[model samples]
Target: MTRGNQREKAREKNLKKQQQNKKGNKNDGLSNLQRKEKDAEIMRQKQAAAAAKKK
Candidate 1:
């Protein structure tokens, strides 16, 4: 029906938007392992800062 067509169009629009947003991401080209390593390094730096503050 007409309602079903509208729902399908909306779903397609949302998928396109999501794909566009993904293209704009900062880690667009990085591999999963590299991302994890970068995140872990950031966490370590934050932990060291917190420890220094507590001392």
Candidate 2:
């Protein structure tokens, strides 16, 4: 019975760690995507300004 209980505890600990890691990855990915989108928007704005200046 002790061994079984120990195994269950270990499994739960590992599962929790895995879930935390996945959450971290998802958060990182979302932030990177947002940064890229903002950068693209800035580039587009700069290009438009340049075109306006040329005309």
Candidate 3:
């Protein structure tokens, strides 16, 4: 009886974690393409700064 209770608790916890992960991913402000574009812009700025320093 105790073992069954533990298994039920574990199953509920696992379900909660899965739901949280699904909601967390959806809350991200940027879509995949926007994220990639922002990253590329940041990289370009860093490269420009390095080039300026070298000159």
Candidate 4:
């Protein structure tokens, strides 16, 4: 009986965590293409900075 209660509690905790993850995107509702473009731009900036540091 105690084991069953623990299992139920663990299941509920997992479900709550999943729900929080689903809501945690920080993209400001950008579409897929826009998000990709933004990420690419950031990567380019980082690469440029690294090259400058190496020089």
Off by over 4 Å in 3: 26-31, 42-55
Show the colliding residue pairs in model 2: none
* C-alpha RMSD of each candidate structure in angstroms: 2.7, 9.1, 3.5, 1.4
Candidates 1 and 3: which is better by lDDT? 1
**In model 2, where is the ten-residue run with the lowest total lDDT?**
24-33
Give all TM-scores, in the order shown. Answer: 0.58, 0.47, 0.55, 0.81
Candidate lDDT scores, in order, read 0.95, 0.88, 0.91, 0.96
Per-residue alpha-carbon lDDT of model 1 for 1-55, expressed as tens digits? Answer: 9999999999999999999998889786899999999999999999999999999
Q: Which 10 successive residues of model 1 have the least lDDT summed?
A: 21-30
In candidate 4, which residue pairs clash?
none
The number of the candidate with the highest TM-score is 4
lDDT at residue 19 of model 3 (Cα atoms): 95
lDDT of 2 by residue, 1-55 (tens): 8999999999999999999988876345457779788878999999999999999
lDDT of 4 at 26: 73
List the candidates ranked by lDDT, beginning with the highest: 4, 1, 3, 2
Q: Please give the lDDT score at residue 29 for candidate 2.
A: 47
Model 2 alpha-carbon drift over 4 Å, by segment: 26-55
In angstroms, the error of model 1 at 4 is 11
The deviation in Å at residue 51 for candidate 2 is 32
* Cα lDDT of model 4 by residue, 1-55, tens digit: 9999999999999999999998998788999999999999999999999999999
lDDT of 3 by residue, 1-55 (tens): 9999999999999999999988877426998899888889999999999999999
Candidate 2: C-alpha lDDT? 0.88
**lDDT of model 1, residue 40:** 96
